[model samples]
Target: MSDRICCPLCRCAEVLLSKAYPEQAEVLALLREHGPMTASEIRAKVDKSIGVTAINNRLERLRAFELVARTRYGNGWKYIAKPEVES
Candidate 1:
């Protein structure tokens, strides 16, 4: 993956990703830094208030934006951050 992860929404200064979707950004950063990981693993490292379901929800939304992708791993799924999309 070349260690370069990027998302239009993440790069957009207008939206201020940290302020707008802190949880989502944190999730993305985790995946980018740690390589592929299951949703449960993400839930474990994220804020105590964020649950597995919420992590899954964030993964789904990230998938919709092409910022991250998930692959079947055993009985669960592992997510990987996608490279930057050229505008």
Candidate 2:
């Protein structure tokens, strides 16, 4: 991977990434590399071994932070990264 760990939302520099959990950072990086995806897809995409429950939890947390947006997709939600616009 490219190692440029900027926030998928907010465009925060690597410094801001420290605020997120390691898993959350990984999730964001995955989304950035790919695109919008479901929690399941994220779990499958990440290189490290992560559980579905953990991936789902991180997705929910990111969405709650407005770093990512979720849309209803069948029974689950499809998550997308939203760039944070400065006010």
Give model 2 RMSD, 1 decimal.
Answer: 4.0
- Candidate 1 weakest ten by summed lDDT: 1-10
Give the per-residue lDDT digits (tens) of candidate 2, residues 1-87.
Answer: 225434554345433664547678778777767888988899888754778888989888777767688889999988887754543
Worst 10 residues of 2 by lDDT: 1-10
Judge candidate 2 against the unseen true structure and give its global Cα lDDT, from 0 to 1. Answer: 0.72
Give a tens-digit lDDT track for model 1, residues 17-63: 55677777788889888889999999889887978999999999889
TM-score result, candidate 2: 0.72
* Candidate 1: pairs in clash: none
| Reference-based TM-score of each model | 0.77, 0.72
Q: lDDT score of model 1?
A: 0.78
